[model samples]
Target: MIIGAQSALAQIIDIPNPLGPEGLTIPGLVAKIATWLLEIGSVIAVIVILWAALVFMTSGGNKERVTQARQTLWYAIIGLIVLLLASGVAELIKNFLTGNYN
Candidate 1:
């Protein structure tokens, strides 16, 4: 039964070929990596923002903790903004290279 289940799971998992019939070129791979990085950065920023908010809420009238939370919130916001700009720049570069700037 365990072997059968493992086989079923393996069959269900579709592992993509790095250089498949669909022509996974270097530029395409770089673009996909950039997109994944942007996605991960965004998620991290969101998590940091939420953690800062929680810290702020749980400070219990502590001035130092409140200040720390505020700083964390500001840093997270800045990081998120930077990530967004970086993604935009990456998209622009990709478009320029691919001649899709119409």
Candidate 2:
């Protein structure tokens, strides 16, 4: 009985493939996700920049607050740099895999 039930369940189940057939391959998927992340990251970076500017403006001439705001701004810049590089790398990988890396 158990064996018959297991066979019936297996036959009724159809698993979908995320990286095969009609969908994007692994590298292609990664590149697509990276592109989306870059777009989202750009928006987030802009918000962070605005927040950091607000912090600086409200620092009231305090050295500690000014330094904190500066650090936050710098960190945002660095995060953008990293995001760009990562997206670039993903593109390169996708191109190389697709044989379009001339």
Candidate 3:
């Protein structure tokens, strides 16, 4: 019991919340906001692109419009594939940082 208590004390770190004004610096706040904006913007862009494709698919093949619809669907698919690859890379980076072999 005494050894367990000593081990716990050694592992504890007193880190303050960096989001607090007193704790975070200007550059840190800017980086946090930028990260949030990038994530939100990516999600919004994906949703808009998917919605556009759905509308295009629902439209009957009216010559000129059919070509445009096909192009939109193709681009959306490519964008999604790119996002998937990025996600895979992110996971790989996360695992590497955490020293996870699996």
Candidate 4:
């Protein structure tokens, strides 16, 4: 009967699953996703910076416009810093999992 076969299968020991190519693991998966996010963020940052540069160039010495442009640039710089920190943390996690310190 099916129940008998199920019981027999349950008696067998559990075997670990094999990892496919590219060394898939929890940390590896996290690092891969983080890298992807970093790439996307970098692209967005570039776009924002370029937009800010264009704004500044078009401000034509107007104080208010220049202030807005500078603010945009400042925000972009903060975003870049946060993204860099996140990337560093991802790298740290990857290294820790790989047993590579310093």
Best-performing candidate as measured by TM-score: 1
Q: List the residue pairs that clash in candidate 4.
A: none
Sorted by lDDT, highest first, which candidate order results?
1, 2, 4, 3
Each model's lDDT: 0.90, 0.84, 0.68, 0.84
Backbone clashes in model 3: 0
Q: Please give each candidate's TM-score.
A: 0.79, 0.69, 0.47, 0.69
* For every candidate, C-alpha RMSD to the true structure in Å: 6.5, 6.0, 12.2, 8.8
Alpha-carbon runs more than 4 Å astray in model 2 = 1-28
Q: Pick the candidate with the highest lDDT.
A: 1
Model 3 Cα RMSD, 1 decimal: 12.2
For candidate 1, write residues 48-97 as lDDT tens digits. 99999999999999999999999999999999999999889988988898
Q: Write the per-residue lDDT of candidate 4 for residues 5-25, one digit (tens) a residue.
A: 456557767766554455598
Model 2 error, position 14 (Å)? 26
Local lDDT at 42 for model 3? 70
Residue-level lDDT for 30 in candidate 1: 86
72: Cα error in model 1, Å = 0.5
lDDT per residue, candidate 3, 4-99, as tens digits?
455655776788775884778775675577567557757865776777677677777666666777677677667767666765676677678769
Error of 4 at 29 (Å): 1.9
Task: Give me the overall lDDT of model 4.
Answer: 0.84
